[model samples]
Target: MKKISQKNDKMTTVSLTQILENGIWQMEAEFSNSQYYAAIGIVRDTYNIPADTHPGLDPHCHHMVSYGMSGYQWGDGAVNYKGNRTEGNIAYKDNQIIKAEYDSEKGTVIFSVDGVQQPVYVRGINEKVRFIIYMCYSQASCTIRSLKKLIAPTTKHVANEIAVQW
Candidate 1:
């Protein structure tokens, strides 16, 4: 692991593997002062990246975005931004996503996410559904964990997602 800073020297690395406990992959991010915090994003046909050359399909596609959360002007935090039709071609805005696709028979919810253009074989996400995927520029600093361990999982008030598991 690499040290995050010269001041405190916190080791840092984002896990590619889902940290599933009961049966899901849940992420929660919060804010403090919000100059910019550590963040990761998957590139796709969106974000001005060309479709054919889009990193959404590439396993090595990881980018960085930013946000300022001091005053919560953007409601700045981990966002799963979605665009509306009247907002022109791109409708989704920046948001924090807490979505899940569960298996009724197997009794397991989706523990992974579809990279930008990568085909997801989730139980419900069919190929026809459209999702606007984007990157995190800058964001607040907060501990994010699976909901099984959440003391208080954020709701739609400050967070945004497609579906809620609970």
Candidate 2:
């Protein structure tokens, strides 16, 4: 794990992680503010570290899912990067845990707000997906509270020769 920070402590921050195949990935972020914006992104590659208050992913191609005072959307590259609202819902808001859990075995990613699953953004994301947490526009901020990656459980075949006890 690397110690990454936002370019400006008062405005915005970007935290990125490499998604490993055959593993389960989970990231939790704490957000506050009603006028500013907080969002999450999954990129095919790493974003330029130490993002400023500019409020968008630079030098990286990503699929973004934003949830907060700014509303919700699924976009490519940045927050409201397209200037258009897509089909999505505002999953959560101030002082809540926005979580992302990835299952490599199923090639699926799940987003939840305060432990309640929202919806699966999309399937078949790259095995090496880049996870990003960002907040921009206005004086709001977001913190990457926790990030963990665990090996997916494996199933073992049992032989019928083993006696069964009821």
Q: Residue 87 deviation, candidate 2, in Å?
A: 2.9
**Residue 151 Cα positional deviation in candidate 1, in Å, after optimal superposition:** 16
Candidate 1 error regions (>4 Å): 1-13, 16-18, 36-59, 62-140, 149-166
Cα lDDT of model 2 by residue, 1-166, tens digit: 2333334334353547455455788877776553334566554444345435333333332334333344422332122332333334344665787776766776655666676655334456554665666654454556678778866522222232121110
Highest-lDDT candidate: 2
Global lDDT scores for all candidate models:
0.25, 0.50
lDDT by residue (82-151, candidate 1, tens digit) is: 2110111111122332233223333222222221211121232211111122222233233332323333
TM-score of each: 0.26, 0.61
Give the poorly placed runs of model 2, Cα more than 4 Å off: 1-13, 34-36, 46-86, 151-166
